[model samples]
Target: MPRITYIEHDGTEHTVEVGNGLSVMEGARDNDIPGIEADCGGACACATCHVYVDPSWIGKIPAKDDAEADMLDFAAAPTSGASRLACQIRVGDHLDGLIVRMPETQG
Candidate 1:
């Protein structure tokens, strides 16, 4: 399992160990973290599972695909280079210390 840290917009932090093969959103959802809404489950159909990858992790995670990039346009906050949909990022040993920060809202 890989341990991931999820930070809320208000500065709350939750760290949990997530098994490999699950998406980052699933990690958050399963841990009962408050930030990521994951409206579309693990599908890339919605942007509700949006989060900003930590700057140190921007180059570590795989780049977001076209569909994920497009869906992010619907995220509540403005998207930047670090913006990513949690559903699109899979958990793995390489991401043991992955960190993500949720935006203020997810509509």
Candidate 2:
């Protein structure tokens, strides 16, 4: 299992345990976390599950492919680095303490 921490725009944080092999968006949604909308249900088509992965963990996370990269453009208040669509990040046993910062808006 992997434990993930989600930081909201207000600086509040929520941490939840997630199963390995599941997507970050699914982890948040399963835990009932408020920020991750996951409107497209892990399809790369929507950016509603956008999250800012901690800089220190950027190297630990996998790089996005062309499809996910294209979808990132739709995320509101986009960031060039550290921003990723949670649906594209799969939870793994090694990511026991992953942390993600949520942005204020998402389409």
Q: Which candidate number has the best lDDT?
A: 1
lDDT against the true structure, each candidate: 0.92, 0.90
Tens digit of per-residue lDDT, candidate 1, span 1-107:
89999999999999999999999999999999998888889789988899999999999999988999899889887568889999999999999999999999898
Residue-pair clashes per candidate: 0, 0
Q: RMSD in Å for candidate 1, one decimal?
A: 0.8
Give candidate 1 regions above 4 Å deviation: none
For residue 60, model 1's alpha carbon misses the true position, in angstroms, by: 0.5
What TM-score would each prediction reach against the true structure? 0.97, 0.96
